[model samples]
Target: MYTVSQDCTFTKLRSDSTLRVLFSGSLRLKCKNACCQRWYFTFNGAECTGPLPIESIIYLDQGSPELNSTINIHRTSSVEGLCEGVKSGLVDVAVWVGTCADYPRGDASTGWNSVSRIIIEELPK
Candidate 1:
């Protein structure tokens, strides 16, 4: 499963007999100016559920406004961990935080933005 937001793609990967899901994603933020900001984030199936979020790491890239960059958050959290967390029922929700610093260097009016409380269910192991 996947959803598109702000030019960001979030994909859920799974297999039979597995309760874990690998969330692979890429986000792009374009400003009216010539600069660009891109971000990549990933989550384990376990972290995609419940009322509280499972501890996860997010890697971001704010490169040239006109160019595309890739950030692989999965590399920091291996697929194995994702599976374990889901199997243990230790994941609940995922949260994303965005600040004006994430946008263009000079554009400060955007203020703070966030993508929080993303509800995700754990598959039956």
Candidate 2:
């Protein structure tokens, strides 16, 4: 099960300005069958075109307690287009935690819980 702890929405920003995106979340693995799990923060929608700026991949062990992780990205990197879209009001900023099983293949079981919080802030250029 996945839960959103905090969702932050920002007004349209200036396209030429720099910004910072922060993704923080906690995950707990409850499945004994799951050998390993990986988590990361994705930008925009899950299906957005172009390359998505993802945070560093976090690996977790099965039956592990709640683990907290955070990823920080700037607007000038590979996610410039996304930043521009947010600035132009054509897109909104959102953060989500995505996880996948690493050990068993073709396993459709769901025995994990996660909570995520996203924050977007504009920085002076």
Candidate 3:
């Protein structure tokens, strides 16, 4: 669990203030045919409904799709979205990621000679 904010208080956000989440990372996925990965930020343990989630669709090598290759490729992606209608006094912000694809025999790794980051900011509403 990643800590987005820690002001030593639960009420870090006010009703007049709005918060947004940003995720930046590189994903390494093995492409057999095609794969679509979904990523989203969770507000204090629940999925945020304020902004659209991130979607990454990767296809097999155009040159060869039936090759039984066991290699993974790296793709960098970033997503930033607002968290609307969130409950007040929430302190912890989390991130969620999952893979959905046919014949999902591949694995995803976020650590590949790169650092992942998550930033949360408060804005005046």
Candidate 4:
């Protein structure tokens, strides 16, 4: 069993299904500063295959939020639009993880030095 959420409360995801979904999202931390990274998700079923590049490490920069400040996965290619609607109080799911990031470290033990995982199922249109 897995717990999922959006910009709000926690919800559960169904684990009995044959299809499985997984993903991650976060903003680049520039110069040890706090940053807010927003990631949109959706279902990219078994048909959704690719050599998708993973942004494992994001570089942070001051006043750089204006530089392509959004992580977007097309609605036509996956179920992102619908899932986003669900996040805004539309549908439901068994497992979901959304909006995560590593903030700048302030105490050397906390903040931007961490990693977050964002997972969501791929649904068809």
Candidate 5:
């Protein structure tokens, strides 16, 4: 699921400027065994593309039935990243998951017990 932050809006003092994007917060995530959960950022309806994008990949290995182990339905955790070279303008910042369904996707939960946040800082260079 993509968590779109409509509240994130900023005016760039210049045209075609760069921005430092960071998406950090807590979330409960779970998926099939050997499946990797990828966390990425999107700005103005476009995925952040570059040599350095705001994305986090966490490889999780859990659940053993034959060993009498219980499967983790969802693990609660947080993510953090700092991506540069993102074009700045009248845009919307969003957080999205990629390629989860292709790898036996499960689900992600958040904004229930805590208030997550995103920050978009304009650098003065």
Candidate 6:
């Protein structure tokens, strides 16, 4: 189970623009559940239809519990075509965490934790 506590929306991005997705949060696992967790970003809205071309995998263990990561996406001519239908409207960008069986046992809710924040920012040319 995965919960998104915060989501950042963007509307002014152009086909020629490049952007970076910043994700920050923390994770804690009991015992020796240290493992690699994979996460990805998806776009859902009037124009965009599916997951972006970026993905990340982070390792979480008793030694390290904090997560701070970034994924950069460039809107090239080829990829820009995918967003042409978007026109001018807010697009919802989401971050999803991959499932892991080692998640704390108990209620499904206990198996997941909240993502502190997901931010989208345009990069300078």
Question: Could you list the CA RMSD of all candidates, in the order they appear?
Answer: 11.7, 9.5, 5.1, 12.8, 3.5, 10.8
Please identify which of the two predictions, 1 or 6, would achieve the higher TM-score against the true structure. 6
Top-scoring candidate (lDDT)? 5
TM-score of each prediction: 0.25, 0.46, 0.69, 0.19, 0.69, 0.45
Number of colliding residue pairs in model 1: 6
Alpha carbon lDDT of residue 41, candidate 4? 33
| lDDT, each prediction | 0.31, 0.39, 0.57, 0.29, 0.57, 0.42
Off by over 4 Å in 1: 1-30, 38-87, 97-117
Error of 1 at 40 (Å): 5.2
lDDT of 2: 0.39
Please provide the root mean square deviation of candidate 1 (C-alpha atoms, Å).
11.7
Could you tell me how far off, in angstroms, the CA of residue 93 lies in candidate 4 after the best superposition?
9.7
What candidate 4 gets wrong by more than 4 Å, as runs, is 1-13, 18-26, 32-55, 59-119, 122-125
TM-score of 2: 0.46
| Candidate 3 vs. true structure, TM-score | 0.69
The true-versus-predicted C-alpha distance at residue 117 of model 3, in Å, is 1.0
Q: Write the per-residue lDDT of candidate 2 for residues 33-121, one digit (tens) a residue.
A: 33333333333454223345444333334432354332221111111223323343443455433445445321121212443446566
Find the number of clashing residue pairs for candidate 5. Answer: 0
Q: Compared with the true structure, what per-residue lDDT tens digits does model 6 show for residues 1-125?
A: 55442346787456455555555554322223344444455556221333244454444443322444222211111012122233334667665555455543211111134335556665444
lDDT per residue for candidate 3 within 13-111, as digits (tens), equals: 576666776767786656555544445566666666655443333444322445765557786767677776666675666655564545343455564
Candidate 3 whole-model C-alpha lDDT, 0 to 1: 0.57
| Model 4 lDDT-worst window of ten | 73-82
For model 4, residues 37-106, the per-residue Cα lDDT tens digits are 3333323211222323122223233333557343321221112222222222222322232223554321
| Candidate 6 structure lDDT | 0.42
Model 5 alpha-carbon drift over 4 Å, by segment: 1-7, 67-88, 100-102
